[model samples]
Target: MGRRPVHVVGRVIVGLLALALTGCAAPAAPADSALSLGSTAAAAPVALTASATAAARTAKIYSIRTTDATKGVITVIGTLSPAPKTGTRIPLHQWIPSARRWQEVAHGYSSGTSVTIKTVQPGSVRTYRIAVGPQAPYAAAISPMISFKHYVWRGIFKKGLLATGGNATPQFNIVPPKEGPRRAEADLLADKGGYVWGEVNSTGCSFVRNWLGNLTDGTVRTSLHNGRRR
Candidate 1:
């Protein structure tokens, strides 16, 4: 074969150099690209505008009044304007008496114009609050405390009375004293005191009464097995 032409080597070198130059140049970016490093082209920080914060603070207030002793439910109504910005989410929290702090219950995007929370029973009294910004800025009204009480009445025959038709009688009672055994020492004690008593035909009888008390100071006391004559 004829001597390899010197121009062939030169052409190869030129092509390689062209390719290297093309690779060194920055790649083309989309028109909406956010990868710019210059300060002028940098992404603007998302801020919670005063108006948005105010709207969040103005969330409508609804009360949940429950006479039920077991559980309580509350419904909250509110509206959002201009939708929440990215990286921002709505938060739901309930007041915790034991912890003496607010705890997060649920979180969701602010996509919808309105937000509603249903059946929030994490605490005896739950308060709902929202965060419009990265940090919490608005708090909903403190929901009425849902009083919970277990009204349970139990009766057990006195160990000895169960076997024999003893004088002992089974009795049921209520709190805040009411009618029932009057003269009987057991009845008298339970009446004058905080409990109510029922008749006892069997060896032993017992009862329990329950009710909701104010939040300021609440207490529940159980009675002793034997009645105190005093």
Candidate 2:
């Protein structure tokens, strides 16, 4: 009977040891499962990053200059962000008051990130801008408007003048004094404050008196009339 009790104790100890091993092994299952899940999550991020859409490009005109006043030549310089492809077409636009719309005046090709466009426009004051059309993966963009003023030179003198649609009876003889050849030229210019001024110059004979009329919206044309001589 004592041997039977000892055998029963031995079986009980073996059962406890097995239970302890099962408990220890149970904890290891969670640790190994957690490690495997973390590795799977790390690779899942690669699939999440597949083929993202590209960002749109930006365009702007940084400078506009009247490079040649005499020729009325202007240059429009600008840049495109994330630089566009080589030879991309960039167009220059001019605001037409008569049509009340924008007109394409000139165009240039892109070189690196920069583009330079030049056009000759004279005899008017207006607004200008540059634009680029959407060329795949890039959005269409336009630059801010820039104001440009160009003047035309006019001459008035013994190149005798007559009033349009007016009676000619009051005409005074404007013979340049026989002393020398006389000539006069004038142009309408604007100040930085947007004030318009008429400038006149004469060679040989001098203009003794002058007058300038108020600028009105109807003043689409600038005219210089010479009166009296010294």
Candidate 3:
């Protein structure tokens, strides 16, 4: 039996080579399906309350509610119903005036029925909408903008000591303003004081940026004010 002095090393090398070739011949795994349960298509417009007409035209309305500021519990309820459809998911989004962007807040399947969102921010106006089809939709509600008023000092002072011919330093002081009674109109007119200070601080920057921010903030305040009235 020992006569051949079997070439065990050669056999082991061949076996390893065969195993390596086998691994190389194996097929790759398949990719996952593109369709996801939570995914949806662009949403269609739905009727909104009279107070939300302006926002509804430009932004979709999803849901609205009043809540206790301290406990975060819902006190008022509002809901939106989309047209009947199958395999459709609707997402609620809010317009962020500061960022000038729409952000998704919540999402769920629209079973041709109304889903209520509860425990929302008190005195806070919000928007929601639905997305249908295979592609994700931009469904959203544009809550009427809320108005917030704060005071700002509109004075200037010297920056450095009396001896140095220091440049004038602009200063501002923010103070809370009184709330006005809700108006009947969908768009509420509210006065805000802090924007002027923001503009003053952004003096050296692009005028457009400062202007846009102030403008958007003002618009949001007006929207919120109107939304609350409804």
lDDT of the candidates, in the order given: 0.42, 0.66, 0.35
**lDDT (Cα, tens digit) per residue for candidate 1, span 1-230:** 35477778889999999999878654645343444454544423323355455643343323333333233344444445434444345555656688998777665454455555444342243455544443344433322333332221122321212222212342332322233222122212222224433333432223433333322233534433444347
lDDT of 2 by residue, 1-230 (tens): 77999999999999999999998998678777778688786777676554333446777877877786545688889888767789999999999999999999999999988999988876577898888888666668887788866543223443443332212222223335353233232233443234332223344332233444544454443354554376
**Alpha-carbon error at 127 in model 2, in Å?**
1.2
Q: After superposition, how far is residue 65 of candidate 2 from its true place, in Å?
A: 1.6
lDDT of 1 at 113: 55
**Evaluation by TM-score, superior candidate among 1 and 2:** 2
Worst 10 residues of 3 by lDDT: 180-189
| lDDT tens digits by residue: candidate 3, 164-213 | 11123423322222221111111112344322122122222111111112
The lowest-lDDT stretch of 10 consecutive residues in candidate 2 is 163-172
Model 1 CA lDDT for position 145 = 31
Q: Where does candidate 2 clash, by residue pair?
A: none
Among all windows of 10 consecutive residues in model 1, the one with the lowest summed lDDT is 157-166
Clash totals in order: 5, 0, 14
Q: Give the TM-score of candidate 2.
A: 0.46
Candidate 2 Cα errors over 4 Å, as ranges: 1-54, 152-230
lDDT of 2 at 91: 94
TM-score of each: 0.29, 0.46, 0.26
The reply for model 1, stretches above 4 Å from the true place, is 1-69, 85-89, 97-100, 107-111, 120-123, 133-230
Candidate 3 ranges with C-alpha deviation above 4 Å: 1-63, 67-69, 73-87, 119-230
